[model samples]
Target chain A: MAYMKDDQRKKLAVDVTRNSKGATKYILITISVLFVFFMLILPLFSVIVNSLKEGLGFYLEAISTEYVLAALGVTILATVITVIVNTFFGIVASWALTKFTFKGKQFIATLIDIPFSISPVIAGLAYIMTFGRSGWAKPVVDWINDMLGTDIKIVFAIPGVVLATIFVTFPFISRELIPVLNAQGTDEEEAAALMGAKGWTIFKRITFPHIKWALVYGVILCTARALGEFGAVNALSKTRGETFTLPLEIDALYLAGSADSITASFAVSSILVIIAVIVLILRNIFEHKSKANREV
Target chain B: MAKARKFRGGRVIPGFGLTFGITIAMLSILILIPLASVLFQSFRLSPSEFWGIISMPNVKHAFATSIGCAFIAAVINSIFGIMLAWVLVRYEFPCKRIMDGVIELPFCLPTAVAGITLSKMYSTKGEIGGPLFDWFGLRISYTHVGLVIALIFIGIPFVVRAIQPVLEKLDSQYEEAAYILGASRRKTFFKVIIPELRPALLTGFGLAFARGIGEYGSVIYISGNNEKEHTQVVSYIIMQKLNYLEYESATAIALIMLIISFILLLFINIIQIRQSRRTNNI
Candidate 1:
């Protein structure tokens, strides 16, 4: 019996050694982890480290003047308007989506996803063709320009920039809100209504809590995308470097053959990185809480 | 309860009518209007003119390089993306959270920033690119090589993120069962895990490819975007036309890009439906 048991054990050991699978699996996994680790951090590291760089301070000095300041103000102004308009519409649309069902329901959902799927450059061209020199927007603009004698370059101006950003980011909020409302179920809202809650009261007390974190997530992502949007703005017209956003400013610097401006680009980018990290952490928290609550 | 039953007037789920109305209006303004405008403008161009435009040596080359390079990048990203997603989900290791954080960086950073940094680093005198150029003559900038690298950088995250969720949802029991039967891990993964991941993997690849096709920011920095068959993409060509105030030709090129994207999207959508049906049968 002892001899038989020893033979079996030896055979098992040989089988394990011959398989040679475990080592291969571990190696594959290690390579994957390292690849992601490097790709994600490397460029980010380049940006953050390069920002405070003393190597390229000369060019950074050139663009740090009032010109960039105006660009910064324009960026912030565009972002603020974008967020306000998107949020108002995003909420109303999400609410309407959650509150009622009508014809072309699926079609609408598909349409919202279009901005996400198509190229941002195409979006820029669309705005230009529809609103530029001989665009559909031309008549309105000519009317306004003739009446007020004020030039409104909606195709190249801040308003155009704002509109483009809005198109690019419109989906973020609704996409976030829909999933949360769908998952939360209607139990609470029905209960609130049963207690004589009006539409506003129910939304304020019951529905809002279910979706607040998702709203925040959507808002942060939208803000980031808007702040850094490039393709549309670049294609539309960057006639005046004075009107350049930080990103466009970076592109200009790169074009001008000054490498130091890269660092300043990273400095502003680091702020975005910090915001992204915070949002990710919040997402983790919200997800964990929801999962735990589901178990309870 | 069931799918159709869930839509029944429960008073709590909100009415379908209101949701449909707002959604359509929002979509029409945001998506349909913009896309249709491009098509409408393109209609002004004669067929001969559109064909003549595409036959131009420079335009033809840009289109070829853009399509060809985007494919290469998407393919490379798919392999890496699949491996990356698998590792993140299957293993518990030190700095796993940090790894997770890093995988998401591309999604967070501006494409322009990514482009600038990549272009600089790959320059002959730039940090990483310098040594590579010196040792192997693997010049990335002002070449098709550079365009591919930029697309790979911007595209990989989509594949990884898309696949990761599906990976996490997968049950580990299948792997365990294969192991119990003395099947090799390689066999188990290929036969069991990979089959399940096929749909998601393809979708991710399609998305990354589509993203690569539209790429403008990152590629512009790395690829000289010179009209000389060097790094110029179709989007750059369109920009040139627009810059020259040649609106009709610009719209024509854009219209071509639009159709290609739509066809590819349709192919993916069909595959998705088939995949869902197959899964339901299982």
Candidate 2:
């Protein structure tokens, strides 16, 4: 113990404390990394690997089946429709909220965010209550049927599926655009108006250029969400093969209680996972670009 | 002054009348009517009937399990999410961008996919669960723990994203001053850093908790759906009731969920407003 000189002993004491602190930091980092790896990354890798566990023949066979193709078609159709409708509403709502001052403006903003908070199941049930067999829309359905001599189905049909999708995804694009437009403000828009530019022309020349990326970002997110919708679509889709979207098909296959169906569930999940990865990549790029633009 | 303001041109650009009209019309048809109809339908039942449905022991149990699991999951996410945000902000590491990107997977991935994948990975005979059961006699899947795990999976990104930017924007001078004053790192962290992070933390917690409550797809498979075991969530129960053609009861539960969610949403909005006000002041 007495072998070391006084200053050297002090230096050694300092070294020990710093080393212990370093060790603690390393432990914390290790735990954080391991937590993410186990909780997030591992399950993702397992799903992807399980999808390819069978030979290429099995995978292709599973994916190319008639049911799977139909499910894919439904998902694409729903996503395209959701993106278009929601994109239009998003633009108009954001434009009005940002470009104009009106009574209950704050109230309207809060109203748009309602869909985000409500459960998808509740949203589905809400639709059912409004448009199902025992719903408020029975009168409307009857009127249509009597007037047109045609039975038009709203609930438990494709229209119901599309409406529920729209309901669940209603807020995504508008929520995205509100902040961007709010920040960009009325200066450019007001200046363009002063130049005798009409609404469409002003939007095309000034507003659209600034908001094009944000619109795409919102549309992509809306489409991703719309494609993956389940509970709402599940409520409206009582007929299995007829109303099933891709996510519903995955759930159906998993619940079918057969080995082949279970494997196919994994395969379908692989497709959704691939789409999610693409969305994540696009989101990252948009985030980077927006941040750079903000700095400028 | 306000009256004069109201009488003036509503907007600088044209289409105030047209755009406002369409926006409100779309909002009404798409969001307001559908959500309101559930409440209106629930109102059809007499007061006694409303009480009868809500007072069911199974319904009570479902609410308890759903809210309880979500609360527990949000708490877990809050602690670990803070650690994660701190790590991401305070240190440089390999594959950091990938880690950052991956945090939002729960947001983009379909909840059903998350549900099935989680169930497969955590079932008793599965990879993580197999060794866990063999080593520790713990069964996660088809249990309350599994349900909480699923919620935590979906809720983690909310907390991490909420805190990351706040941590990045936090000034280092506060920590440096605490250090120079001879306060230990632990003391500085608890005293200096956490206080500044409280708003963001609360917002994240509320967001995660609300999301956890409304979660249906990711939790259904992992939860085991054991009504007798108190694992069935309200959302699942609503779906079950609908399947059974019990519209009244389903609407009743839906209304309950709607009320709780609206309260939470209002709370988060308040926090956000306060937060923005603070940033603007700064």
Candidate 3:
């Protein structure tokens, strides 16, 4: 009878622990969901609601303003140029750092990551100090402009905006590619070199295929960042319609302090919101593709 | 060292020179030269002059607000981040994939959009802020409390992303052993699980803290930037200097921030290296 009673107590203990485990799981899930909902999801939802607070027609008119369109153009142009330039740099840098051994390789890698740590405002300020009037590079910039017989501005212009975007996003593609390339090792490339195959040919046939998804992944991230770049671009792009990107335009509109403009700001923001959503979806898809490639 | 030099020279790659040349040239033009400009501009000021600019009461207050808020936000994120990472990795739930994807929204979304939306939502008349204020006489937007809320929003992804992989790769055997050794669930989690998660948690905290410290866009809208003593952040101070065209002062302040960032980066890198060494040893 005493042994039976002990067994009953043990079963009760197991049942109590199981119930507590279930309670813990549900509580954790609820807290996480609530936190994300309040912090992330709710704010994003309000953007849509606030954008349409007036009417569908107002939303359309807000987004169709000339300045908004121009800002959109600048944003797309900067993103495209940055992606092309950085993609080339990323490919070459990753190739050099991973395919061969060299001095200061670690230093170079760290240098590429410098932008990630530096504030965007500092990056923009650095450009202003470099190419603005009284800057060290002012003479060089003027010489180039004089030689070309063209009046070109660097600091408070499109060039400065693009330069800042590039500085901020310089590391993304290379950062993504480095690990994949490092994991690939150099055995195949060495064998191909031994067979008298040229670098371009081997890269096209082997390396390109391997890093294609990763490159796409990197480019997507870079494009998203460049498109949304505000702080750096803001420090340099002082003029509204001329130099502003989408994010800057949003800031200007919101700070305009009229209810109409605030609504308009949300309206303009919805365009970026849509683009960000698209980018996020693409990022998810490409992330999975890259992971699958790695697994294989 | 001699053997290493030989191995370096023995690389079979054909485009080493070509690739290395492009990489160095671009790196110098895009990164090194521009950053040097900040350093050189600040160097033009005397040490006392530099100290005077960054040590102003307003500037000191801004720095304090920024660092203090960022630290608190990072701490809060680390706790919730662990819970989120645990749920995502260990629990099966509906819409888990969608939830996972939503975590990257802050990373991809324009900071301006996030700034505006968050400010509106937390403003006195808005959805969440309305009830909050009425029930508790608490205000969020246009205050330092609002600043922390914005920082917390931007920082969520950093902690979660940092801890997710580590949590996923954790061996459950240790936890089972602790449990079987008669430890309660709380004891097992605190003693066995948390110690294992320490490196990842610290990494997430560092990253979130660093990001928050440098954050400008999201905080600016909600921070009610008019209050110089309470809500002004270091980044906004730099912006204000630029608006007045006080380039030297801006660069000096930026230099201070740059130094702090480098120290934090070094700290994180050391942690990562140690973590890797430990993993390899095991």
Docking class of 3: medium
Ordered from best to worst TM-score, the candidate numbers read 3, 2, 1
Question: Local distance difference test, per candidate?
Answer: 0.73, 0.86, 0.88
Candidate 3 deviation (Cα RMSD): 5.5
Mark the regions of model 1 whose C-alpha exceeds 4 Å error after superposition.
A1-22, A55-63, A95-104, A144-151, A185-197, A259-296, B1-19, B268-282
Per-model TM-score versus the true fold? 0.87, 0.93, 0.93
Model 3 steric clash total: 0
The best candidate by TM-score is 3
Candidate 3, B1-282: lDDT as tens digits: 335536667656689889999999999999999989999999999999999998898888888998999999999999999999888877768988878888888888888899999898988888888899989988899998999999999888889998998876666656666777888989988998899989888888988898889898899999988654478998999998998999999999999998988887777777876897898687
Candidate 3: tens digits of C-alpha lDDT, residues A102-201:
7788778878888877678989999999999868999998999899998889988999999999998999999999989987878888789889999999
What TM-score does structure 3 among the candidates reach? 0.93
User: Positional deviation of A264 in candidate 2, in angstroms?
Assistant: 1.3
**Candidate 3 or 1, higher DockQ:** 3
Give the per-residue Cα lDDT of candidate 3 at A97. 92
Summing lDDT over every window of 10 consecutive residues in candidate 1 chain A, give the lowest-scoring window: A9-18
Better candidate number, 1 or 2, judged by DockQ = 2
Query: Which parts of model 2 have CA positions greater than 4 angstroms off?
Result: A1-25, B1-10
> RMSD in angstroms, candidate 2?
6.6
How far out, in Å, is residue A182 in model 1? 3.5
